[model samples]
Target: MSNDMLRSFFLGGFECSSHRRADGVRLDLLRTTTHDVLAGSDYRQLQNCGISTVRDGLRWHLIEVSPGQYDWSSFLPMLRGAAECQTEVIWDLCHYGWPDHLDIWSPEFVSSFSRFAAAAAELIRSETGRSGLYCPVNEMSFWAWAGGDSEKINPCATGRGAELKRQLVRAAIAATDEIRKVDPQARFITAEPLINVSGGSGDQAWQTEAENYRLSQFEATDLLTGCLEPELGGRIDNIDFIGLNFYPDNQWYLGGSTIPLGHHSYRPLSDMLVEAYERYRRPLVISETGAEGSAAPAWMHYVCSEVEDALRRGVPIKGICLYPVLDYPGWENDRTCEVGLLGTPGPGGERQVHHRLLDEMRRYGHLSDLARKAGSFADA
Candidate 1:
């Protein structure tokens, strides 16, 4: 089979609402029925678009309230519907929100999360009869960057305090381990934003900060891989797979007087993948990769070609996922709708993709196939 034949594409699920508020932010709580409609529509769209797998979010806060009180009424139907459609679901257990009642610093938080994970795993396995993929938490570093450092989300904290960071990591590890107990065959993908930062001349301090930011992505992965550096070992364990989330604007640089040779431009997504491959040699997946606005198609093709190139060179990349099938409402600065593959519906309700750009992607499918063949031949 060709490389393109072996390679698969996944789409991110969940188009829940999150609007900016006066005092803080408000998450438009998506009920089970609403999710069912969205998930069904997304699955059909993905199937028609040639995507094979779907990455869906299962928010912890939405299912369990206090402790053992579980609410499957909302998510169960959607799961069954996806299964019926023969779509592979990479279940994301916690995207960003926690039960509003649980404190990040409390032991109860960890215990509660563990219980939730085990129960969820059991339910999913029982219903699907497959060891479904699970991401106990999505983008741990990004969560810290937003909630802990930037104070953008709930329980927003600020400053250099390591407590919030530590707690989040702990919760993730606890949840991962608990889920493993219930479904020993479950696979994990620790998805984090592959942020690339740059700096200019006279910005030595900023350059150093940028380097630290890049290193932090690997740091979180290391924790999940159970190889945390001596200073960071109290938090995680080995992950089954490496889930990388990359975007066009995920790279930026600070202007300064003294610039390093490679410090001027953002590192390309290919370079980031090569770095991860060199470090772990695990089966990798671009869990989330897309562009905002009219560049969506071009961005998709660019990222897909990069992944194809990596495959040709023998990278163990398993999949590529376009995030959020629908143009979600209330994106950060209202940019969510623009990142979607299909342009946002207008007053007439028409959705379209740039045909020329999509044709470019189709052309490269052959290159992707060649790469897959190379990898297979090498393995043989």
Candidate 2:
């Protein structure tokens, strides 16, 4: 773990999603989090907390104003900010935002995305002299279900989850291929929500359905690694890390019902981590996890304990990232979600740090050190 590429045992993440809403209004989380305006200060805060590694994103819609041309204006500040703060960033090349002109299902989509990814990689390498770590297309499964099947975004391909998933997987594969050509040392972290589903009634049919639903979580990663579809050009080299995003309500029973945490029916997060690591045989990260307001500290406690348990079980748990480290406006109504360790900004771009949450994180930071020190070498 000495040369851990993440550069930190504990990590923080900025909410950089730039997805357009159902009403056609794009939500720039970076703006809401004020990271767009205060990235340097945000990175300094992370460093002050001993978190040198972080997750940020590229706003594809803003960057690629035209087909192949790129506008780095929106993202350049954050790039400079990270360097100024001496932070290491894992950039999300596409966080649910693409150029308005590109049809998601068109052949041009994959090529355009691949080109953007390559250019982004080149920029990062040229600035940082590192082959960049990336989550090329974050949460493909979730995006497909929320944005593709539902009317959460443009294209509104209702009931076309499978088709959308296939297209997204193709784009991710192509993006990865293109990135490697530009930065051969690049590493990828494929993030998808990790969940536990149960048959609440315990009926045979529901049980089978629940199992299948749970397995569906790995669709994108499976496609990338060539486990299910070799035609996508997936291979061992395509995957470097497995990022399992967890939250309070991640586990649930089928039919949109949630299984309460600590309930017998609710599988522990530690078990889920082991399952992913054993299945993928790659270093794992809790790519995102946090709760809003009052539950924040307690949620971190629970997550830290589960991650510790997983590490003891020989899982190569690399790092735990506190996502949305800064609070942002909710996508549904622009109402503020007080889920970050830091709160809303003032005229000077200063956010109020939640002392309680900061204390909890610092307290758990010690445990993370031990967890990393004892991780399994096979995945490392």
Largest lDDT belongs to which candidate?
A: 2
Q: Which stretches of candidate 1 lie over 4 Å from their true place?
A: 1-7, 10-24, 29-35, 203-206, 229-237, 255-264, 332-336, 342-361, 367-380
Residue 111's lDDT within candidate 2 is 90
**Candidate 2 pairs with clashing backbones:** none
Please provide, for model 2 over 1-380, each residue's C-alpha lDDT reduced to its tens digit, 9 standing for 90 to 100: 34444688678888888878888888889876778878998888778878899999989999889878889999999999998878989999888888899989898999999999999999999998766999999898999998779877755668988888888989999999999999998889887999888888878988999999999998888888999889878886787888988989998989967898878898988888888987888888899999999999999989988888877778878888888888888888889888888888778867788889888888877666665665543355
Tens-place lDDT digits, model 1, residues 301-345: 778777776776677677777775555555346434555554444
Which whole-number lDDT from 0 to 100 does residue 249 have in model 2?
90
In model 2, how large is the Cα lDDT of residue 147? 75
**Model 2 lDDT vs. the true structure?**
0.85
Residue 172, model 1, lDDT = 72
lDDT over C-alpha atoms for residue 338 of model 2: 88
